[model samples]
Target: MKALSTALTLAMLAGLAGCVGQSGSAASAWYDGRDAIPPRGDRIYICHAFGCALKTPVDFAGRDIAALRRILAEGRGSPAAERRAIAKAVQWQERRVGKIVGSDKDVGGLDMQNAGVPGQMDCIDEASNTTSLLLVAEARGLLRHHRVESPVARGFFLDGRYPHATAVVRETASGTAFAVDSWPEANGVEPHIKPLAAWFNDYPS
Candidate 1:
């Protein structure tokens, strides 16, 4: 039933404004019509309650930037090392933003039980938020080996898979995109970062 709910939630959301999931330009159209990404290290919008039904503004102050810089510096040597550091950076971001929005208590994945509630994040929410955080790191010049790309989605309900989305990063050297997915885990835990190709066909099994 939970799986059904997840598919329903995603399908229902995609129907709104005829917006598809967060992939390419579609992500902007879905979230508050935010067609343009804000300046780096600026105030960010947190998407929760599924389909970005709730958007809360959160600022990344100097302290947060400092922490991000320090964390990302650890991965400057190699793309592999940077990805590990990216996970740490994302974990920190989840904790930081969660405290302000009370999303620290949010359950992971598609949670109809917390629908319209204060702190539930489906894959869409997770994808958007993680993308925003990654942009901040990129803007602050904290990212060295990988360039943050637009968020992407996979699956279609008719294909026997639930629609899902995730943030992405591209390795500058190899041009390989990796999925940064947070919806499968609890808040503050690092998302599963995997090759985007693998993520698209076989995830959330």
Candidate 2:
């Protein structure tokens, strides 16, 4: 709904650049596909029900934001440490928001048993939600070593795999990219933070 055409156009260009897409509005467009309201300020749209087919708006109070700041403050040592804090923050957000959005029951990857139902999240949903969480942290100046980036997608239906996407971040010092993927973990579990290249090479398991 917000910049759908722009996202689609960027995705097309990313495919031409080299296989599907990588980081940026393409991921934002992924959310737009389901009419998600982008994360901004203290309000975020928690995406569930596969492909962000459903979005639940949750607002953070001052206490909630303070908790995030404290959680992230522990990672100021290095990029690697910050990544860990990021995973924790993402988990915290999931657990806290799950109560409101019901994603607490969400299993990693596709919850085939509950496809298109609330409490489940597919890659698209995971990627979009994770990206939103990262953006929230980044916007508040909690992240210093890395920056939230556009969501990245890999594998076409014909690329020996189904389409999949993940949230991404780039190291400010070295520009190294990493995949912040939570689709492989159950709700409230720490997400997998791996280099983007490695994530692309391996299956999204």
Best-fitting candidate, scored by lDDT: 2
The TM-score values for the models, in the order shown, are 0.84, 0.85
Alpha carbon lDDT of each predicted model: 0.77, 0.79
For each of the candidates, the C-alpha root-mean-square deviation to the true structure, in angstroms, is 4.2, 6.2
TM-score, candidate number 2: 0.85
Expressed as tens digits, the lDDT of each residue in 1-205 for candidate 1 is 9898777777554643223323442244544443323333468888887767778888888887889899999999999999999999989989998888889998876567887777688877887788888877777788999887767666666566666777888898998889999988889999999998898888442
lDDT of 2 by residue, 1-205 (tens): 5587557555644533322354553346555555666887888888888767788889999999999999999999999999999999999999999879988888886457777888689877787788887788887888989987777777654445556677888999998999888888899999999999999887633
**Residue 23 lDDT in candidate 2:** 55
> Model 1, which residues run further than 4 Å from truth?
1-41, 203-205
Query: Which residue pairs clash within candidate 2?
Result: 24-150
True lDDT of residue 71, candidate 2: 90
Query: Relative to the unseen true structure, what is the Cα RMSD of model 2?
Result: 6.2
